[model samples]
Target: MDAGAAIWEYLGADAPVADLPAMGYGEVASGYATTHSAESVGIIGGGYVGIETAEAFAEHGLDVHLFEMVPHTLQPFGAEAAATVEDHLRKQGIDLHLDTAVEGIDGAGSVERIGTGDHTVPVDLALVGVGVAPNTELAEAAGIELGTTGAIANDRYGQTNDDQVYTARDCAEATHTVTGEPDHVPLALTANRAGRAIGATLAGDPTPIGEIAGTAAVKAFDLEVARTGVIDEESAAEAGFDPVSVTITAQSRAHYYPGGEEIQITLVADRESERVLGASMVGREGVAKRIDTVAAALHAEMTVHQLSYLDLAYAPSFSPVWDPVLTATKVLHGKVAG
Candidate 1:
C-alpha cells in the first residue's frame, strides 16, 4: 500500500525544508536525512511524534523548542492530560511555544531560524513533525473512493472502490468501534492488523478488519501516556451516549510497596447505559499494561460495573489489591450507577 508521505504539503513542495540543511526524522520512516550537527533544534508541531522527538532531542542535550499552533499539545487527550504532559515537558526544559504560528523559515543557505509572530528562534536544525495524511494520490488517480478522512475507502475486508484493488495500512480508512463510523487512526497496530486481514482476504479466507478503538500509548519523559476508545464527552454524546467521566490518582502498586507510583486514570462511561466508553491514563509506572485492560473492555463492550469487578491479578510488586484500572472503573461505576 502507498502508506503516506513524511512531508506535509503545506511544509512546502516535495522536499521539507528543501533549501534548508535541517533534518526531518519521520514518525514512521526516517523522513529527511541529516549529516550536519547542531546545538539547538526547533520542532514544529506538538502532537505525538513532535513531542516524542523533542524529548529524544532534549535527552541528547540539544536545546529543543517545540511549537504548536494549538493552545495545547495532545488536544485529542483534552486539556487535563495535555497539561499533565506539558508540565513535565516544561520541567525538562523543552521550550514550548503553544498557540504560536510559524511565520516562516528564514536562513541564507540553510535554516538558521524560525519566526513565530512575537519571537524569532534561532535553530541550528528544524524538524517538522506536523503529522501525515494518507497517500491517496494514486488511489484518487485510479478512481478509488476516499473516505471523509481522505484515506482510501475500504470495507471490512479491505476492498477498495475497485474490487480488484485493496487498501490497507495508513492509506486505508477504518471504522471506529465505539461510533461505528469511518475513522483514520493510522497507528502501527491498526495498520498491521488491517494488513493481516487483507492478506487473509486475498487468500480466499475473508477475515474482518475489526473496528478500531483508537488505542495508543506513548512515553513522554517519565510519563507513560495511554488513551483508548470514546473518551471525549462531546463525541460520546454525539454518538447517542450520555457520557460521564471520572478522573482519579491512584497508586500503581501497593501503597507500602517500594516502587509504588501515582497513576492518574480518567474513565469515561455512559450514564444511562452504564457501559464504559474509554480511558486516558498516565504515570511513571504501571500505566502501559493497565491501559491494555481498558482496550480489552472496550472490545468486549464491558460496562464500568463489569470492569470494576474484573478480578484482575494483583501483587504489591505489580499492582495494588484494587488495580488502578479497577479503582478508576469502580469510581466511574459509582457515578454511572448513581
Candidate 2:
C-alpha cells in the first residue's frame, strides 16, 4: 500500500513516494524485526491502529512518539474519554503529539526522522497508521455507484445500485440504526453479520440486515475502553436529537470489596424522548463487558429511566448493588426529568 509515501504525499511531503520504506500492516512486523535495534520510533495517526502499535513498541522498551492531526486520539470516543486515554498513554512513557500533522519523513536512504511543522524528531523506524482507503477501482470500472463515503453503495440486502452486483465489508456502507443514514464503519462483527445477511438474500431467503450502532472496544495498557451507539454530541444533534450526557465514577464491585476497582461510565440520552443514546466507559477492569449492557439498551430503544432498573446481576465479586451503568443512567434520568 506504500502507506508512508501515501501519508507523506497527503501531508505535502517533498520526498517522492518511491524514496520511502512505505510498508503496510503485513510488512510492519518484518520491518520491525529488522529495525528493533533502532532507539526511537515515530507513528503517524493516533486512531486505533496507531495507538495499539505505539503501545507495542513502547512495551518492547523502544522510545515511541505518536502524532495525530486531530485535537485528540480516538476521535470516535467522546473528548473526555479520549483525554482519559491520552493521559494514561503519557503516563506509560508514550510521547503523544495531538493536533499535529506529519509534514515529512526524511533520511538519505533509509528512514531517519519525522517532521512536524515546527520541529523534527529523529527515528529509526516510522509507521503510518492513518486509516485505509478502499480499492473500488474494479467497481468504478464496472460503473458501480459509490456512496458519499466513497464506498460501494449497498442496500440492506447488500445489493448495490446495480441489481446484479452486491457488496459487503470495507467496500460497502451500512445503515446507521439511530440516524437512518448510510455509514461506512469497517468493523469485524459488522462485516460478518452483513455477509450472513447477504448470503441469505443471495440464496433467495432474502434476510435483510438491521442497522448498526457502531459499538467497539479497545485496551490501552491496563485501561479498558469501550463505546457504543452515538456518543458524539454533534453526531447526536445531527441525527435530530437534543442530547444530554452524564459521567459518573463508581466502584466496579461492592465498595467494601477488597479487589474493587474504580470504573467511570458516561451515558448520553435524548433530552426530549429520554431514550438512552450511547455510552462510553474507561476503567482498569469491568469496562469492556459493561458496554454491551448499554449496547443492548440502545438496540431495544430503552430510555435512561428504564435502564436504571435493568435486572443486572450483582455480587461482591462482580458489580455493586447499583452497577456503574445503572448509576450513570439513574443520574441522567434525573437530569432529563428535571
- The true-versus-predicted C-alpha distance at residue 259 of model 1, in Å, is 1.7
Q: What is the lDDT for 328 in model 1?
A: 87
Please report, as a residue range, the 10-residue window in candidate 1 with the lowest summed lDDT.
1-10
Candidate 2 — worst ten consecutive residues by lDDT sum? 4-13
lDDT of 1 by residue, 1-338 (tens): 11123332222235433444334333323322233346788889988888888887787678999999889888667666788899999999999999987787877766789857568899877887788899999989989999988888888888887999988879888888778888888899888888898899899899988889988888898898889998878889888999999999999889898978889888999888888888888889988778889989988988888888888998899989989898888788778888
* C-alpha positional error of residue 58 in candidate 2 after TM-score superposition, expressed in Å: 1.0
Each model's RMSD to truth, in Å?
A: 6.2, 6.3
Q: In candidate 1, how many Å is residue 318 off? A: 0.6
In TM-score terms, candidate 2 sits at 0.89
Evaluated at residue 83, the lDDT of candidate 2 is 91
